[model samples]
Target: MNDFTPSRRSFLAGSAAAGASLVIGLNAKGALAAGHDGALVPNPFVKIAPDGTVTVIIKHFEMGQGTTTGLATLVAEEMDADWDALQIEFAPADASKYANTLFGMQGTGGSTAMANSYMQYRQAGAAARAMLMEAASLEWAVRASEITIDKGVVRHGDVSAGFGELVGKVKETAEPPSEPILKEPKDFKLIGQDLLPRKDTPAKTDGTAIFAMDVAPEGAIYAVMARAPRFGGTVASLDDSAALEVPGVSAVKETPKGVVVYATDTWAAMQGRDALSIEWDFSNAEGRSTEEMEAEYAAALDGDGPVARDDAGVAEALETGTAVEAEFDFPFLAHAPMETMNCVVQAKDGKVHIWDGSQFPTVTQMAVGAVTGVGPENTSIETVYAGGSFGRRANMDSDYHVEAAMAAIALGTDQPVKLVWTREDDVRGGYYRPMVKHRVKMAVGADGKLAAWQSDVASKSIFTGTPMEEMIVHDGVDHSTVEGVSDTQYAIPAMKVSVRNMETPVPVLWWRSVGHSHSGYAMEVAMDMAAEAAGADPVAFREELLAGSPRLLGVLKLAAEKAGWGNDLPDGWGRGVAVHPSFNSYVAQVAEVSTDADGRVKLERIVAAVDCGVAVNPDVIRAQVEGAIGYGLSHAMRQKITLDSGEVVQSNFPDYEPLRINDMPKIEVHIVASAEAPTGIGEPGLPPAAPAVANAIFAATGKRIMRLPMVDAGVEFA
Candidate 1:
């Protein structure tokens, strides 16, 4: 696909030619910086064109998450610019300019896109408006304070001019402000509006938006690798005689991961890969089945592990009070995005150029540079729209990108190569959500209230062996393994949480909501059980315990009210509710479900209430919450990645099914009004869904589902 961003086409060209444009740059600390030729250097984040078009550079990748739209709204609202004149472009691989403040790296995950960059982009817009006002003041012989900009036009009393007319003067005379005053929430026009159209919807609906899969360089070749069936197995030997005979096949080479087949096109490459014969070694491969792993994980829960959190007197409280015990099992899961993993790499003259749905451009640049003998400064990445990547594509090791770089280097030619992972490859590929087991024992005090809570969690650690080990692992505990449990919002007086990180060859990574996926399920289900033991309404019990947490209590109350918690349902129908906080956002979900005589569940409706602090875009937030509900239900209902002696059991959507459209429940999202800083909505809406549904099933059938992917627990969802 052709380069969609005006960054390379006009922004850079305008700067080089000193055209009629005003460019404002931001420094590392968000202060104003100079552009090219003693003027403000084009920071690539903000550009004001002579035609009144305002383009904002987005550092986060858009993966059907509406991140592009959310970030652009910040600029348009702060600048008082016309919404139709706004544009968005993905930032290039420059960590110094675009690093995520939360991670100190250039990446987009953990729903931190909006949270971390909210002020940065707002400041960019405010600064641009300041410069434009200053230029208009100079032209009209009025004080800067007397000038005002509204909808791409500057006016001072009777004098009026479009922003396009002041571009030349702003470039020559206006000075960039280090601290630009931002508009308050009350003065906002587009920030909270639900009718504003998304910038990407036009191109996406017209099929003109560039995705990584759509890029095909002039002389690029297609590459397909024949990897080991099981994880940790390497190539022992390969015979490429038949592969070479295949039409359009050029060469077959061996890399650390697998043997690669290079062809003139994807079809020929796939055919050549199938024709090649390879022998695998299982010396260090995972040989155990999922059943065996589950047994081991369950056993680990019996032992006292590293303490993630400890409140006072939890053991004695459990011994003295009435104990309510439960165990929940969650299986490994695949991301299974619509567009599979693919990237194009070109390495020539000690410079590497990559085109991909780059979630972490800084890491990809470094990984590819290391392989191609090109330094970081010589490597460049062009980000494109990704179909979806719940948590894939942001690999800490840059797996697929390095594989393509190695393939390009192995060819020893200038021909660019596009590495493609077929649907089977994408599904069977590892880095799954770690299989986890949670065992909880809750106690009711003499007052008949939730008193003490103790939880033992066992799972493979996602950050222990990766580059994030030093950052995420603390005091022998992988925090990601026990997030929702350790940092729960519920006001449990006496609580103790311990975690055991099981060593395994099966690679694990953070799924949507990370640890909250399983932790929230266990925590909320235990809450329901505790409520029953106390002989209190589930909503009332939670409200009492959550008295200290206003946001959590607020959403829970809102969701209960919206779902008609006290209303009578049909004989077979039941209502269940759960509230959770993750990524600084609180979400509560209430699920209404009914079960047939055969114990098959039909989820009828879901009511969700979220307080993400100052809803930037209510429409996008609603869409995200609705979409998260479906994604969460898909995994809780039917999806899991199991192994039969180290080989993935399910290959595609047929066997590893997603939620069907016919089974989708009626979803209603309600957003709380708040003026606080905006938090993340991407992953927070997901953690509460499964638990609410599970709780609803219990209310309906009087049966507890201890195991996940309800199919395995003899419970099916319709």
Candidate 2:
């Protein structure tokens, strides 16, 4: 991916270098620019030199989302390009050249890349193919309709010419049709098929994946920081005399928030950082703990705040005797990606280069450029595949990158400096999913149906202070905070929802499903309770509420059918179902669970059905659903990050335990086929799992556990 904007001269130069005889005029943007004009183009332009070699530039950063292969498929499909002869390269960070339409930014998130770019990339491919076909038709003196393209070659009867051979003669032609006919889905030979893993699988299996830890630049020193233990607490002072005396330790620098220890390698840096003595500022804590935050959140729910949505007289309805009230609590959660946080940076000759496994490479580049007082053009960001992101890598606080860049400058060495955050640092350093409390009141009519609903959600705004805050938050309501609930498909006569922003010192971010994680739990659990109150089957109850939504009803019916919703299960085992629409996709899940005599609950199976329009790759879609169920179940079962005196208490896997293979459930995924453009699959599957599991637990034990980590509610699993 050449991030550089291509000037006309550079475009011609590049084409010539590839031995392409065609005179290619670049868009007005300079070569390597991310945005072309005002539009984002993450697809790379390929040029075949007269020498027959192909170069492909990719715009989206590759971070294990299979963007590399997905984007490549679009180009190959359109170009009729020879896959074996083409080489792929990374695009540079230039927002002007590669803005994402879904985010209106130059990066990937929200699972919108594939769906958004599906058509644009195909058009790019079709244009290239048209040119080659025309060139072959001209040479063969045959009608263009008689020409066919296959593997980078244009064929007319027995005559054929490679794309490279036709490039020179095809230059300066009018642009191909803007709305070229797309290949029929049935005719797709590559788009929906499983592609051989291209980049990471081999590297990881062979232990050569260049994660941040593996980035060892020449003369690269190591730096470690002793950051504030408590959120928003700055370091008062540091005693680095002993740290400087440690073997291989070179220098110690004081930062605004912490002390940095520089050494020859990571081990030395770790030793020096440990030996350094630092004075803490506990003033920011004010004795606030998780219990205190929980109380504050509960208090806010009772007071007036911002009204996000109001459709009817919810207050009057809730005030009547026919209403059911329930409160659900979700604790703060840590991203806890396996790789932790680390960045390697080098500053030399007014140029900054960085190597990091970040989900937000453009943001990282912009932050580095801003902090170093350099132009964005002067910075280079190289993205490596992250072990896992789950939104942690999308940090607005570029603490790791800033520390490394500053250390490199302070050390006065052209050598790169790698700053690593230990597992403890990563855990204790802020940026957690906001803890949330929901107070819900629903009015049930004598007819056993919901008449009106009122919900008050209290939580620290995930968007209040981040770069994405303005775009995601409006009218004092963070849409990310009420996704599943606000856009619920259920048909209630009236509904009122309000959000009270709880200002807390803890830094929060959008975790995987964002608000859907907790909001889905609260909404679905409430729905299940309503169903039980109505004396109706859960599936039938949901179907009645979702009468008008065909897509929702479709998934709901499919999931229930697959889970054998009405069939009798073994004694003590119960089934629960939940449906949600997010990221343009509708998902429904049914969880089967059993409770032992001693009250231990075990989730045995999960049946998932998704209507994501068209399934570009059914296998990948199923894999995503399975992965989300596993992740969602982990959070539902025991994943939580508790704060003690404003500091995270869970430091590693031992404390924040995720599910293991032994706890794996039998997962069945069904994709509802449609011709509608593909919607997201990455995070949508997650929102329904927790609620489905909770609903199942309620069926098994007749207990409506309102709090998360069912463990917290004393709902133990065997």
Q: Say which candidate scores most in lDDT.
A: 1
Candidate models: Cα lDDT each? 0.85, 0.76
In terms of lDDT, model 1 sits at: 0.85
- Worst lDDT 10-window in candidate 1: 1-10
Question: What TM-score does each of the candidates earn?
Answer: 0.94, 0.91
Error of 2 at 117 (Å): 1.4
Model 2: residues with Cα > 4 Å off, grouped in runs: 1-56, 82-87, 161-181, 194-200, 207-209
Local distance difference test, candidate 2:
0.76
Please give the lDDT score at residue 29 for candidate 1: 37
Model 2 scores worst on lDDT over the 10 consecutive residues at 16-25
196-260 per-residue lDDT for model 2 (tens digits): 44533566799866777788888888888888888778777778899999999999987654778
* Highest-TM-score candidate: 1
